[model samples]
Every structure is written in structure tokens, then in C-alpha cells.
Target: MLVVSTGDLMMFGISAVALIVLAYVIQKTRLGRALRAVSFDRDTAQLMGIDSTRIIQLAFVISGILAGIAGVFLGIKYTLYPTLGSLVVKGFIASVIGGLGSLTGAVIGALLLGILETLLLAALGSGYSTIAVFAVMLVFLLIRPQGIAGSNVQEKA
Candidate 1:
């Protein structure tokens, strides 16, 4: 925990993003192309002699690495308590408000959440921060369930 300073947070953010990008590139490689073929149509991939299990393993590994790094940052930014990361409902709200399962939506949602929370806390009080964020999330949900960017994510995408 002591090692997770602000500098570490900055480093982690940069490195993790770089790694994820690299992983994406690797996924686009020959092996990655094979994996994509498998994901798009498993029966076709298998008929074409592609190993579906390995592709699934690689996909899970890539996602796991990214999620682990994000969890680490969460731990560093907050406390060591078991419930520390769990209390971050705004992040969840942001993810949902941005459009479910859409990466761009999640990012935009996070930015909106952070800005809104900051402004509300300044105008009202810290106690109303979560409330404000949640209120915005609800409004967005009612107004546009697809999010500000629209429902861009398809089940197969």
C-alpha cells in the first residue's frame, strides 16, 4: 500500500494503457486474426482448424490484465479496506450512463461524473456529491438509455 503513491498511480495509468494497446495489437496479429475469426464464428473457425479454446484463453488473459491494473489503481486511490473499491458507485453509474459495454461511453461517462461531482460538491457540500452524480445518471437513463453517444455497441461487436 505504501508503494502506491501518486507517482505510482500516474505510472500505473500510463503503463497499463500502453500494455492494453500492445495487447490489442497482438490480438490483431496472425494469432489474433485467428482469434477474431473464432469469436465471430466458432463453428467456422473450428472447421478451418483454429483452436477456439486457446483464443478464448488469450482473450480472458488480456481482459484480466487490464481489470487487475484498474483494481490496483482503485486500491491505491482509496483505502485498503475490503469495501473500498466497492463503494465507488459513481464509476458504475458512469459506465452505465455512457452506454453499457461501450468503452468510449465509459470514458465520457467518467469525465461527466467527475466534473459533475466536483461542481456539485463545490456548490452544495461533500455529502451531496454521490447524490448529484446519481441524479445525473438517473436523468440520463430516463432521457436516453443508449447514452449520449447512442447505443453503439452490438451484441456481436
Candidate 2:
């Protein structure tokens, strides 16, 4: 049987709120616009007076902060281990499944991955979860390499 505590619910709430705020910040603020502009075309953004270097630095800092928060939550949920960094592979898979640069895609992909892993574990066994997840990822890559929300564009060489 699965058991959930108030703490878990609270943490989930906090995570959801943080994600919403992040989405808003990325979608509605001038800084967000600048960030998006820098991502889309750094040279053009620089020509328009956006400091690409500063924007890039800010993005890194923000990513670090978010990662720290995630680390804290992960530590609270699971005992910290020296090899916990290896779990980044799951995150990479989620990103690939969702689409590399789409925040919404990442979230959806993560949720989908979690659901699929749980179902696979229940149906097969814990040992099969990783294999199943990777198999699904491989299938997705073969069928839709751009991911659920990514666009496929040919780049000029």
C-alpha cells in the first residue's frame, strides 16, 4: 500500500507553486523577455542593447538556485547519497521526452515518465522500471526525435 503524509502534500504544493511562479516569471516579465531573446538570438539581442553575457550569467544563477531547491527536496524525500548525482540521467531523459528547450514539455515529460515508471514497476518489477523507461525513450526518439513540444528545424551549415 502507498502512504502519503501531510509533509509530502505540503512539499508537493510548494513545488507546484514554485513552478507556477517560475512559469510566470519566464512568460510575463521584462527580464524573462530578455532571457528568451538571448536564448533565441544572442547576437540580435545584443544589437538591441541586451547584455548577452549578463543574461547568460543570470540564467546560470537561476538554474543553480532551482537545482539547489530540487536537491533539498530530493534529500528530504530520499536519503542523500554520494552517487545521487547519477540520477541526473532521469532528468535528462525527461528533458528529451518533453523537448529540450520547452519548460512545459519538461514538466509534462517528467510527469509522464513518473507515471510510466510507477505502472511498469507495478506490472513487471522494480528491476524493470529503468529498462522500460529507457525503452520508451528510445521509441520516442525513433518516432519523434523533437519530443512532445520541440520543433524540428533544419540548420544551415
Candidate 3:
């Protein structure tokens, strides 16, 4: 029997709410549109009368805020150490598995990675599971470099 603590439940709730809010903001807000436009093409956004500089600054600020919140959550979950950033490799792999530029894909990839890693750990051992994760990532890259949700983009001549 698996018992979950209230703290874990609260953390999960907070994470879910944050993701939902961010998705809503990016999908439905004017600032989000401006951000997207600037990201797609700064020069074009400028030509369209969008202040690319301001939007870029706002984006930096928002990213910093989100990073800070994530750091806090991580700290709450684990001991803080300089080597903690090494774990980001898993995140990068998850993003690659889901496909770059697709938020939904990234989330799904992360969940899938977590499930797979957990199963591997249970069946094998920690060391082997870690190696297997890297192996799986390599296989994905070799076979489907665009990722599960990423579409192949054609460059304009």
C-alpha cells in the first residue's frame, strides 16, 4: 500500500495549477501573442509595431520568476547542493523525447520518462536504470530526431 502525504499532494496541486495558468496565459493573452510574435521574428514584430525589446525584457523577467519558483519547489523536495543541477540532464532528455517547441509534448514526455525510469528501477537497479534511460534517449535520437511530437520543418530558401 502506497501512502501519500499531504505535503506531496499540495506540491502536486501547486505544480498543476501553475502549468494550467501558464498555458492559459500563453494561449489567450495579448502579451502572450506579442511574446510569441517577437520570439518567431524580432524584426518582423518590430515592423508590426510590437516593441520587441520590451517584450524580450518581459520574457526574461517571467522566465526568471518561473525558474525561482521551480528552484524553491526543488529545494523543498530535495537537499540543496551545487551538483543538483546535474539532474537537469533528465529534463533535457524529457524535452527531447517530447519534442522541442511543444509544451504539451514536453509534459507528456516527462511523465513517460518518469514512468519508464521507475519501472526500470524496480526491475533492475538504480545504476542500470540510469544507463537505460540514456540508452533510450539515444535510440530516440537516432530513430526519431524530430521527437515524438516534433514535426520536421523545411527551411525557406
Q: Best by TM-score, which number?
A: 2
TM-score, per-candidate, Cα-based: 0.67, 0.93, 0.90
The local lDDT score (0 to 100) that residue 130 gets in candidate 3 is 91
Candidate 1's residue-wise lDDT over 74-141, tens digit each? 66666688767545676688887888745567778878877887789889898887677778788988
Worst 10 residues of 1 by lDDT: 148-157
- Model 1: what TM-score? 0.67
Which has the greatest lDDT?
2
Distance (Å) between predicted and true CA of 62, model 3?
1.7
Descending-lDDT candidate ranking: 2, 3, 1
Candidate 2 clashing pairs, residues 3+ apart or interchain: none
For model 2, state the Cα shift of residue 63 in Å: 0.4
**Which rank order by TM-score, best down to worst?**
2, 3, 1
lDDT of 3 by residue, 1-157 (tens): 8898897888889888888888887889999899888877788999999999999999899878877877888898899989999778998999889887677988888999999999999998998999999999999999998788877754533
The CA lDDT at 58 in model 1 is: 88
Question: Whole-model Cα lDDT per candidate?
Answer: 0.74, 0.89, 0.87
Q: Regarding lDDT, does 2 or 3 come out ahead?
A: 2
Task: Write candidate 2's Cα lDDT for 1-157 as tens digits.
Answer: 7899987898899889889988998999988999999888888999999999999999999899888888888898888889888689999999889988899999999999889988999898988888989999999899999899987744533
| Segments in model 2 whose C-alpha atoms lie over 4 Å from true places | 153-157
Q: Which regions in candidate 1 have their CA more than 4 angstroms from the true location?
A: 1-16, 19-54, 150-157
